[model samples]
Target: MTDFITTELHTARCLLRPWRTEDIPLVPPIADTRAISWNTSLKFPHPYGEEAARTMVSWSQADAGVDKWQFAVFKDGQLIGGCGTIRGEDVHAHTAVVGYWLGVDWWGRGIASEILAALVDYMREETDIEQLTATCFGWNPASRRVLEKAGFRNEGVRKGVVKKWGKTTDLWVYGMLL
Candidate 1:
């Protein structure tokens, strides 16, 4: 297996780097917001607590140098959110699924777009990945805009593919080739 090194990526306003145990305390409060959780995968707990934050930090640390690349998004030296890519296996090994989320307080500021563009560039330069894919809830136009701004194109939507928080939602798929 090839060993990969995790490094910090900087944008104009944000810093993307590997998560530290110290970051656990900053996660739950930002992640627990309903606005943030509803647009993300179900794995992101809505009632996100200290335990969940600890688990995530631990998992992120363990996944370092592996196929999973998770980064803590920091702005002004404060942990504000995260973004990552999980590589596919077997015949799909060249592909990766990207995901990201920001604190509700940081929404509508183009932070997500900047972070995503930097992440995409980092992946292209550091890895052999061929394609990156992302999905957004159909109702989340902001996320769609972010993906598009980062050069991902809309593929299609899976109708009512996710049933979360007592509601069924469509999943809008987006992809980019590197």
Candidate 2:
């Protein structure tokens, strides 16, 4: 995957693009705060600082070609959240893991679904990736619905696969094949 053909991506209400320094301040607290911690795989104690965001921006840039990317999800000219793919080492292979999260305040407004849909379209058109996979805690019905609505099919549970806040969690695996 030389790149995901990221010239531009547009959803009905959002735009996805590369991250910038300006977006740092907006992203940290959302990850640090307890509001969205459990819903994401982001490491905890996000520190709400510039360093982390810079690191992320750098990674997104350096890894852009191989299916690793971080697109800033925006609406109304504001940073709403971030979404991207964690490209597998095999570029010619048609697959990658997808992950994303919105600010707590932005939840339940169809934003996540919209973003996911746009990403799916972009991936299908921009790369040879035939499979996009995602995981969500079993108890998180909202996330499950979002993935299903985005055309992901439920696979199975990975029991006790994630440990957050000192508790083990079972994750439901889902995938969409193009």
Candidate 3:
């Protein structure tokens, strides 16, 4: 049997845990929002549905030997969003790229910052990663602020690197050294 690192992380106001099969239904509405997808990677479909959510949950559960960690964000026992890290391999093995998104209802509440801070601390303490990085769309100031407040420093911008909503935009990179 493969040993999997399935763990739950907690913050002052939220719990970050693995996605459950029952959580599939809650994902579609929150993840399908245009506002959430605008700042996320292209892999996050705009019209997220049960199938996508199921695929996500399944993929997250499966261990293919890579150091990828994903968790569903929960507040007051309710699923609010998701966050995770894609750890690099070989020469970049000490680094990982983190990403997160919250439902519209949870915006402006400092939940994102809290989630990142907790996840960063957990990764540093529990894993071998030395650096955590994140990318935010140039048009999304809220995400940028969240990363900043979580102690990530602005690295630089990649011009015209992402095409979303029929427009090509720059991506601001940020990194935190653990």
**lDDT (Cα atoms) of all candidates against the true structure:** 0.89, 0.78, 0.86
Q: What is the number of backbone collisions in each predicted candidate, taken in the order shown? A: 0, 0, 0
User: Ten residues in a row with the worst lDDT in model 2?
Assistant: 41-50
Full candidate order by lDDT, most accurate first? 1, 3, 2
| Tens-place lDDT digits, model 2, residues 53-134 | 7777767777574557568898898787888887666563568899888877789999999999988887787776778899
Taking the tens digit of each residue's C-alpha lDDT, what string does model 3 give over 1-178? 1233457788999998877788999899778888887777778887888898999988877752257778899999888999988888889999999989899999999999999998888787777789998999888999999999999999999999888879998999999999
TM-score of each: 0.95, 0.88, 0.92
Best by TM-score: 1
* C-alpha root-mean-square deviation, each candidate: 1.7, 2.4, 2.3
What residue pairs clash in candidate 1, if any at all? none
Stretches of candidate 2 off by over 4 Å are 1-6, 42-45, 90-92
Query: In angstroms, how far off is 162's CA in candidate 1?
Result: 1.5
Of models 1 and 3, which has the larger lDDT? 1
Relative to the true structure, candidate 3 has a C-alpha RMSD (angstroms) of 2.3
Error of 2 at 116 (Å): 0.3
